[model samples]
Target: MKTLILTTAALALSAGAALAESHAQTVRLGTEGAYPPYNFLNDAGEVDGFEREVGDELCARAELTCEWVTNDWDSIIPNLVSGNYDTILAGMSITDERDEVIDFTQNYYPPAASAYAAPSEDVDLTGGVVSAQATTIQAGHVADSGAALLEFATPDEAVAAVRNGEADAIFADKDFLVPIVEASGGELVFVGDDVPLGGGLGVGLRESDGALRDTLDAAIQSMKDDGSLNELIVKWFGEDAQTFE
Candidate 1:
């Protein structure tokens, strides 16, 4: 009887462990509320954008609930490292500099960085001038080229600066800038061909959370396969702006 009781207790413990391992809950996602059409707070202060939509779909597909926390762009990665959030749904490009600190899931969206100028400005495209935010990869591309570089704390500010003639051009990821341009009426125009910025936005996970990353990656892959990603892109970016590969 003692042996049988001990065996039963061991089985119960094993079952409990299995259940714990299978039902991880409540993934906390982080985003910068400043970047629109990706992840930003709407007028109602609720998160609404492409990334938020995709993140919600992913969470549902993965059978997990998520709570989004807003953090500054510069602090998002650091906060993730410190356990302030589990993943970043912000439209963060996967760059080597960032890769050195955190792990990213497979790219979910491709982005082209392009420079824009006010419609009235005669930007010399023949000169191949590129304006980019100083801290971004786009800036690095033109850092040594002596191109007209205009930097700003946020993409919105950069767009505004261009509209106000503070700068002749503004460079940014295509996905983030397209909507802003449309909303600005005839204030801006693309100055050059869109440049392929390597690395698409992906969910950021801690190095220790490989399992969670794998789960989210699978869900994202499924979304891509079923045309859900394209649908979301079109919904946010308009019919002609949809681009997926």
Candidate 2:
């Protein structure tokens, strides 16, 4: 989960309910292309992953023509307010702090725990330096904890900080970290306890787009009702991942 505080002007734009909607029938979905399983660039250099599939399905159900757009994680919300996109389908958790800047559809993915990964089991989580993507809940948690927080621009960079010994461990979404730890082939291992955070991952939109939010929320609920959303969650995050059901 990630969040960036928007400027006062950006908040003003997001709060303006009467702003002219310029996209017509096409809704542009924004995502961070580096977060695997959630969203990432495929071999074809197109946005592809769990969120992509879900987003496409939602758009189809909502009868909205949609396009995918990628942006850096740190600037995602700001860009959304700036009209770079109409919706944010990134792995964004629903939190009060974020609600002040953007509206969210009901979560498609259930609340998942955050975990720590390290090269060894003995790393001291309470006092050691832990790496996390800047502006993420994990980073906020680490900064608040007794551990020294090391911030990076991306998840890969955070993991690299641990691997290269710049940090003692990397803390991130448990769902996002699991595949990386598994593929690390024992080079990296889960450590410490899991920390549950946020309400779950949902589609983020501007307050001015309440109509669009309702449309997407209904689509997401339809998927949940038919169990297709659960199927997608398992498809990308494995059987252990949380589901709406």
**Candidate 1 weakest lDDT stretch, 10 residues:** 11-20
lDDT of 2 by residue, 1-245 (tens): 11221232233333222222444556899999999889999999999999999999987766677899999999999999999999998898999989999999889888899999999999999899999999888888899999999999999999999999999999999888988899999999999889999999989999998867867776776677668999999899888777774
Residue-pair clashes per prediction, in order, are 0, 0
Which runs in model 1 stand beyond 4 Å of their true positions?
Answer: 1-25, 119-121, 124-134, 242-245
Candidate 2: segments with Cα more than 4 A from true spot: 1-23
CA lDDT of 134 in candidate 2?
A: 94
lDDT of 1 at 26: 66
Best by lDDT: 2
Error of 1 at 73 (Å): 0.9
